[model samples]
Target: MALVTGGSVAGPGAVEAARWWMRMMRDPLATYGALGRRYGDTVRVPFGVGRALYVLSRPEHAEHVLVANQDNYVKAFTYRPLRAVIGEGLLTSEGDTWRRHRRVVGPVFAQRHVVGFAPQIVETAVAAVERWPDGVMLDAAGELRRLTLDVVGRALFGSELAGEAGRTGRSLETLQRGAVIGTFLPGATAKRGLYQRVPGLGGAIGQLDGLVQRVIRGSSGGELLNLLREGGEFSDAELRDEVLTLLLAGHETTAASLAWTFVLLSRYPAARERLEGEVDEVLGGRDPRADDVDRLPWTRAVLSEAMRIYPPAWTIERDAVDGDDIAGVRVPAGSTIAVPPYLLHRNTDIWPNPEGFQPERFMGEQQRHRYAYLPFGGGRRICVGAGFAMLEAILVLATVSRTHRLDLAPGVPVRGRAEITLRPAGPVPMRVSRR
Candidate 1:
């Protein structure tokens, strides 16, 4: 390991670069972890065509890139494959389009308005848990996906999406895998049309399209769909893209968070017991409301800790449009900056016992850096569904934790799949037992 200071950047040597690229393509998380350990937080790797990628994991680095100097950057070209699938939706769109979509779509996910969806979120979770037979092994990841899909369907779109969860989940897996593979290919940007020509990629896009159409046609006229339709800001094709983007983004991240929470709790019985105690004391056998989120600090802490360990939106990237400096690292124009939460959250310098699961970090009024924990990213382009996500996670965790506990099935060692989102690699089989 070496110390990086002053204006000079640090990274792998030319001879080591080939090995680094191979490791990155094979397993990005492990590669990034290796880079952090071997070269410190800010490693400047040579990218294609005389470009450099600076992997930044510090909190101040995140603030510098995502907040203060955001105007000098754009969503990196790495997101091109994603833009291919979802079109110019909120997640991949930029400039005037992003601004306009944010303005139109932001109101629906506002804190005050999202609270109104609490009843639906709770009811959906309760219904799903009630159907689980005791002592039977269930896929926690799949169940969470189903539960979240239902919540977004009923609460946001007034549609029943639980039926399509299985197909939708598979479709997302294919698309995400393809997107990641696409990033490493030469001339990946501006090749959206070529993506569909790939064997399985086209079907993945089609599956998502079918789901969006079902939502639009079967929607009992939810506020979001209505706004997208009546606002006249988006054309018909653009309307479908926006709806599909919300459907995928709205449910996927929250589902991943809850699934990871369940997995973490299973591994740490004490944390599980403490969480159950906190939920029991706070809710008192009643359904959780929006206000109850604040009262249940431990439950929220458990989730925060889970996110710290495995943030769903684990990586954030930006391309420098102009020369800039991040934490004294010289960044030139056209450079790519990767602010990975996985690395930042696990940085030993910032977090004591970095690998340990300690929910208490979020329980007290302990002071920390502002950009230290960015599960939802930073700046104006932060996740709009953030408020909705936390509320839904707390309520669902409370609702399910009240009556049952999910323990990992014996001999099943869950591995994380770092695709578009950081989630369990395969089905997370867990036994459901009565509390």
Candidate 2:
């Protein structure tokens, strides 16, 4: 745990900088989690020459960097590799371009309009669940990915993307691996061209490009597609980037959330029983509807608690545009700040019994720091599709739970892979049984 900065030990540096970097490159999620425990909420380590990275997990730190005094921060260089892939899409874009794109696309994800897509979400989930044969082993992660992709495809683009879900998932795996590697390489942002020259990187981008082309060419003329097309605001490339961003962001995180939910429910059977009971009571053996979302408090809480435990979008990073104080940590200009939800959500001070699965924590009225639970992030850049994601998760969980229950394969342990998104490292094999 020696702390090293600028290749020099500070106050008997508990952890060497090179050791931290090695650990980070190997498994960043565990490294960050351990740092939070050993060094409190904010840990600073010099990274790559004179630059430093501040690992800040405190809710106050998140609020300061992402919301209050937010203008002084921008998406950090860590996202540059992603920007190369997704281009200047809403998720990676900055400044006026981000504002313009947000304006053009924001309304469709508004709560009122998002609720309209619940039927499609539920329909897709039900159909996918129906395909699951009882008493058979299946990969819950893959199934949920297919379901969410289909939901986004039909609801947003009016296309059938379930067939492409597996391919898209593979491509994302490659791209996310490349992105994480790029974050540690020096001058990666400036040398994106060189970075792309690396083996397999080009193929990953090509796969994503091909997917976007298919989405554009096979458009079923959905509402969002129509807006992007008829609005006359985006060029062809811009439109492709936006579609790719939505296609990836819209499904991958939701799939991860659902996947983790199943894993947790399998481990905590009592919670699973309560969840099934709630779903049965709420829907009464019928398909879930948009209105039923409000009536299914436990379902929503289960999803909430799942995301709290394994947030799909686990980490949020931004570069300091100016020097300022955050949660009493001295942040210097040009430093990188990492507000990781994985650590924040598990902070013992913020969440009692942090490691335990208790969906009831989200039930009823409970007072807590706002940024402590940012599965979708916080501030203006909070997920544009947060409402859609939440509603989709609730309905899909309810729909699937109503008809079937998934139990993890005996003696199997589910470990998370912290790539661009937090997801099960390997197949989450589970036995499905008709309820």
Per-residue CA lDDT of candidate 2, range 27-117, in tens? Answer: 8899888777777777787766557888888899999999997998999988888887788899999999999999989999999899899
RMSD of each: 1.7, 2.2
Looking at model 2, the pairs that clash are: 1-14, 1-15, 2-13, 2-14, 2-15, 3-13, 3-14, 3-15
Models 1 onward score TM values of 0.97, 0.96
Off by more than 4 A, model 2: 1-15, 188-196
Model 2: weakest 10-residue lDDT segment is 6-15
Q: Scored by CA lDDT, what does every candidate get?
A: 0.89, 0.87
**lDDT (Cα, 0-100) at 97 in candidate 1:** 94
